[model samples]
Target: MDTIIIEGGSTRLKGQVTIEGAKNAVLPLLAATILPQEGKTLLRNVPILSDVFTMNNVVKGLNIALEFNQEKKEILVDATGDILDEAPYEYVSQMRASIVVLGPILARQGHAKVSMPGGCSIGSRPIDLHLKGLELMGAKISQVGGDITATAKKLKGANIYMDFPSVGATQNLMMAATLADGVTVIENAAREPEIVDLAVLLNKMGADVKGAGTETLIITGVERLHGAEHDVVQDRIEAGTFMIAAAMTSGDVLIKDAIWEHNRPLLAKLTEMGVEATEEADGIRIKSDLTKLKPVTVKTLPHPGFPTDMQAQFTALMAVVNGESTMIETVFENRFQHLEEMRRMGLHSEILRDTAIIHGGQDLQGAPVMSTDLRASAALILTGMVAKGQTKVTKLNHLDRGYYQFHEKLKALGAKIERVSEVEHV
Candidate 1:
């Protein structure tokens, strides 16, 4: 087992850190590779993370020849040859994002059978919206055993509406609508920047998709799609995590290439806590040397709202603030599992249903904590930045699923951290 060991105390994070491409965008783009019938798709700015590897393997398992050049940070996918229809449990079970490939597979091969996917146990992320959207587009879907099989003689477009603006459902349905006949309109679609990134790639691949960064999406079906080159967007969640860490420690850090627009809500929240975030020519520069931070209320919502992903990190910030803060998580249930772990470190917080009342002004002493999910792992590490004594974070595999070189980056910013490996038992 591997753990991130942190010697926590007052530390200043000063320097510029460049972020990798967005993990949320690249996974769906990797799935989008299956839509192209010929030519090679070149993806630029791909993040070097464990989940990306898992999704790449899932793509390759379907007979798509993939070559990843780490130094170049590019993935060359040639899904031009004979494609397979089944995505086995071996690969799909490792990451829930693999469910995305099912839509692309059915769009290209006309039939697909994929094993149920498994990922972070944050909440129940059902694919019913995806299935329902496909069914509206004339695809017959059914659940047999542990697999979902979808088939259509020829998929035709239709008008569909989502109860919630789910990022995964929008990506899957949008990709599936590429080779579909006629036109497909998705109402209440996800307006995340990653969705816009996918739309850019799909359009480059010869699919007519519009209104990507808006509430509605219009995709006109094409006979077939060809490979294209695209650049992935920056990881807003990863950057936001670093931004919060900087603010929590009252440090100065310049996050390079971080899109200010994508992280407006987080920056606004930081500003409310008396943190100074200045938009520079290259990126956003954050400075925080406050003796005390003001408490602020946060409500997690879809894009253009405070993101659910940043809730955990923000809660850590509220732990040592001037007063009590309230946080309501509207996106995922059971996300408060990390709060129980926080209590072990001497933080006080009350959880009622989906809302948490965090009492600040408590001195923190480090303790061993286990990560519950990918974002929870980040939350724990952020808390460790200001905690007294040594903090050891286990279940690093969760952290690795998203952020690339997380410890190395923090270390570069002058944090006392290390990656330790335990002896293997035979």
Candidate 2:
């Protein structure tokens, strides 16, 4: 097992860090590779994360030829040949994002059998929406043993309404609608920047997908899609994580090539906490000189609102801010697990159902902590950077799924952190 040890306390992080492509966007883009019937699809600016690797394996396991050039941060996918209809449990079981391939497989082969997916233990993210949307498009859905299969002779476009703006469902349904018959409309769709990124790639591949980054999506079916090259969008989540680090430590850091419009909510919240965020020509710069941050209330919502992914990191900031802060997680019910872990490190908070009231300005001491989820791992590491003495964060596998070179990036920015194995640390 690997552990990240952080020597926290009054460390001023000052430097510029470049972020990688969006993990959320790239996974669906990788899955979308199956939609093209001929030629090669080139995805640039791909992040080399563990989840990306898992999704790649899932794509390759479907008999699709793919070559990943990590040196160039690009992936060339040739999905023209015979594609497998079944995505075995071996690969799909490793990551929940693997479920996205189900749509493309069904679109190409008129059938797809994928095993139940697994991922971070933050909450129960059901695939019912994906199945329901596909069923609306004429797919016969059935579960056999541990696999969920969707079969259709020819998928016809239909109007589908999502109860919640789930990103995964929007991506899955949007991709499946590419080769579908007639026009498919998605109501109450996810308006995330990643969704817009996928729509851009699909449009480049000859699919008529409109109204991305909005509440509705219209995908007009095409006879077939050919290969195209697309650059993945910047990871707003990773960028927001770094921004929080700079704010909490009262540091001045520049995140290169970060889009300001995509991170408005996080920046707005940071401004509420008295942190200064400037949108520069090259990227977004975060500079904070406040000894004590102003506590603020945060509620997680869909796009154009506060994101649920940044909730954990914001909670860590709320723990040591000036006054009492409130964090309400309306996205995942079990997301407060990190707050319990924070209590082990001198955090005082009260969890009332989905809401957590944090008593800020408490002195935190470093201790051994376990990561609860992907974002939680980064949150714990961020908290350790502001804590007293040494803090060891275990279960780094979760950290590997999202952020790339997190400790190295922080170390470059003057953070006292190192990743070491258990044997090496001893």
Candidate 3:
């Protein structure tokens, strides 16, 4: 087991840190690579994360010729050859995002058999919306032996309305509809920037998609799609985590090339907590001087609101701020598991139905903790940076799924952190 050991107290993180490409965006973009029948797709600025390796292996499992160059952060995919109809249980079982490939495989091969997906234990993330939308688009869905299969001789478009604006469902349906026989309209669709980025790539690949970044998406089917080039969008969740780190330490740091618009909600809340964030031509710079931070209430929602991904990190911030703070998690039911680990580090909190009421201003002492999920891993490390003694955070497999060189980046910013194996740490 790997653990990140942090020596806390009187440490202020400073200096500029570069943000990585969005892990959420790159997975679906890799799935879209299967849709192109000819030419090679070039994706630039791909993040080097464990999940990327899993998704890349998933694409390679489909018989597509793929090359990932980590030095240049680029991926060249030659999907001009024949594609396989099935994504095996070994790959899909490791990452839930691999299920997005089911849509493109069906669009290209007219049949897709994928194993039941698995991921973090944050909550129940059902694929009912994905299956229902595909059924609306004239795809027959069935389950057998832990695999969900979809078959469509020739898919035809229809007006599909989603009960919830699920990002994965929207991406899967958009890719599936891109090669259908007619126009597909998705109402109540996800309006994330990653969705708009996918729409840009699909259009470049001869797809006619409109109204992206809105509730309704109109995609007209094309005979076939060709490979295209695109750059992955910056990750707002990573930027927000570092922003919170800078503010909590009362340090001055700049997040290079971070988009202010993408992190507007977090920036607004940071300002309310008495932190100064300025938008510059280079990137966003955050500065803080308060000895004790102000408490604030937070509610996680879909994009354009406070992101559910950042809720755990902000909760870590709330634990140290003065007065009482409330965190309401409306996205994932079991996301508050990190709070239990935080209790070992001397955090005071009470969990209600979907809300956590944190009584701040308590002295946090460093202790052994475990990461509950991907985002929770970062949150625990952040808490360790301000604790009184040494904090050891384990279950780093979750951290590697999303963040790239996280501890190295923090160390460069003056964080007294080191990653070592369990035996070495002991």
Model 1 lDDT tens row, 1-426: 798989897767888788999999999999999999989999999999999999989988898899999999999999999988998678899888889998899999999999989998988989999999999988899898999999997889999999999999999999999999999999999999999999999999999999999999999999999999999999999999989888888889999999999999999999988999999999899999657679999999999899998898889989878699999999999899989999999999999999999998789889999999999899999888888998999999999999999999999999999888876311
**C-alpha root-mean-square deviation, each candidate:** 1.4, 0.8, 0.9
Model 1, which residues run further than 4 Å from truth? 424-426
**Model 3 — TM-score against the truth?**
0.99
Worst 10 residues of 3 by lDDT: 288-297
Candidate lDDT (C-alpha), each: 0.92, 0.94, 0.93
lDDT of 2 at 33: 98
- Which segments of candidate 3 are over 4 A away from where they belong? none
Question: CA lDDT of 107 in candidate 3?
Answer: 91
Ranking by lDDT: 2, 3, 1
What TM-score does each of the candidates earn?
A: 0.98, 0.99, 0.99
The backbone clash count of each candidate, in order, is 0, 0, 0
Model 3 over residues 245-331: C-alpha lDDT tens digits?
A: 998888899999999988999999999988999999989999987465689999988887799999999998888888899999998
Model 2 Cα lDDT, one tens digit per residue, 324-394: 89999888888989888889999999999989999988999999999999999999999999999999999
